[model samples]
Target: MKACDVCGKKSIIQKSGAHRYGGGWAMRATKKRKVWEPNLHSVKVTHDGVRKTMRLCTKCLRRVKAEMAKKVAKKVEKPAKGLHFCFNKSIQFF
Candidate 1:
């Protein structure tokens, strides 16, 4: 029973119907049990200066990647400490 490490996603059991061809009014509809598993992928991630391998579902993986990208973009967008950024504003005297 493999599951995602980040989200703890696991397999689910469900009932499914059998295929019916043409006009099969006399044929009975058979029900069967089906197993639905999450799409898990093995990925390596670095956190807190430590590298680890984990199994992550598609949704979690996408979220983690997006967060990492945001961090990188934020770092790039930051201005230097000595520089001041002033937006356009009208002069006000009080």
Candidate 2:
């Protein structure tokens, strides 16, 4: 019943069987059905000056984290306009 709120990812059924090995030969047993669920986490998010909680999968969570990091990087102050710094030389303004 758990799923990602962002992407709507859900669980799936996987068919699997047991294998027996003997004398370099392999034998298969009766196939079984298994439920494969996505890795989901409950996260708290803030949007439009409001706080909310959401469920997100691992992939979506990673993407959100990367986007937040980019926002933080953009907020950081950079060198003044027309000013440049060189690794081998001193600072210069153009």
Per-model root-mean-square deviation over C-alphas? 6.7, 5.9
lDDT of 2 by residue, 45-90 (tens): 9989999999999999999999999999999987679978899789
RMSD to the native, candidate 2? 5.9
In angstroms, give how far residue 43 of model 1 lies from its true place. 0.5
Q: For model 1, how does the per-residue alpha-carbon lDDT over 1-94 read when each residue is reduced to its tens digit?
A: 8799987999998976656562674245666788999999999999899999999999999999999999899888664565554566544333
Model 2: residues with Cα > 4 Å off, grouped in runs? 17-31, 80-94
Give TM-scores for every candidate, taking all chains together and pairing residue i with residue i: 0.64, 0.66
Clash-forming residue pairs, model 1: none
- Among all windows of ten consecutive residues in candidate 2, which has the lowest summed lDDT? 18-27
* TM-score between candidate 2 and the true structure: 0.66
Q: After superposition, how far is residue 74 of candidate 2 from its true place, in Å?
A: 1.2
